[model samples]
Target: MSMNTFPIIRVVTKLLIPYILLFALYVQFHGDYGPGGGFQAGVILAAALTLYGLVFGLEAAKRVAPPKLMQRLMALGVLIYAGTGVATMLMGGNFLDYNHLTHDVWPQVLPSGQHLGIFLVELGVGVTVTAVMTMIFYTFAGRQHIT
Candidate 1:
């Protein structure tokens, strides 16, 4: 079956992708205090893109998220994750020690640097995972099957 065979499916997929992405964000942001995190959020994000690809066809998906873009995103995410650790080290603490991420300007009523550090790290993880999974899907989808 080809993409044109299911117009309803395509329409439904289009309708759902935004909500899926939104939910992914929710999981990412609430991860530190709840059941979700970078990994779960990442998977959800990737799933949304994957659903788009399955519904709209692989080429369309690739156009939406090119391989070069995915590669850069993967690198950037890793850098963000590692940079947090390096920053802490430079701040006179061990790697990934969030205590060193503090700033005096932060209000007493607000959460501390630990929360900020975790958020950054999780953001990185989510980015990397999304790119990796999307790339993986593209890789397999782009391959020519031997008949």
Candidate 2:
């Protein structure tokens, strides 16, 4: 029942996964300018990886993105999100405030740090979501039957 047994599926999946990943990145970065955002991007990224797992098998997917790595990424995303808030606070602004981010360093930039803050927060959210979804898929797929 190996995926490689079917050459067509294997080749098609291999060709498609890269495009999926590229689109995910596009969604992630372009979210600020358009309709897409962190949540959507995260789901897209997760879906790509999930597709990879489905086509390649659970073990292969795990080898590529280990559970431990995903767990760490989840924590890291939270830290990035929270740290942005903390940074704003340290800059003498309210929690989650973006204006303070640029006032002290680059006051000349129009729109200030708001956009930057939003981007960072969104990135954090995307990372967290991608990791969680992949982890969940791995857990459910890896379960063994208890007879």
Q: Compute each candidate's TM-score over C-alphas.
A: 0.92, 0.91
Query: Model 1, which residues run further than 4 Å from truth?
Result: 105-111
| Poorest stretch of ten by lDDT in candidate 2 | 103-112
Q: Show the colliding residue pairs in model 1.
A: none
* Cα-based lDDT at residue 95, candidate 1: 98
Give the clash total for candidate 2: 0
Alpha-carbon lDDT, every model: 0.90, 0.89
Stretches of candidate 2 off by over 4 Å are: 103-111
Candidate 2 lDDT tens digits, 1-147: 137577888899999999999999999999988888889999999998898888889988989899999989989889999999999999899999998888446556544688889998999999999999999999988888679
Q: After TM-score superposition, what is the CA distance of residue 33 in candidate 2 from its true location, in Å?
A: 0.8
Q: Which lDDT value does model 1 have at 130?
A: 95
lDDT of 1 by residue, 42-117 (tens): 9999999899888888888888989999989989999999999999999889999989887663667546789888
CA-only RMSD, every prediction: 1.9, 2.2
Candidate 1, residue 4: Cα displacement in angstroms equals 2.5
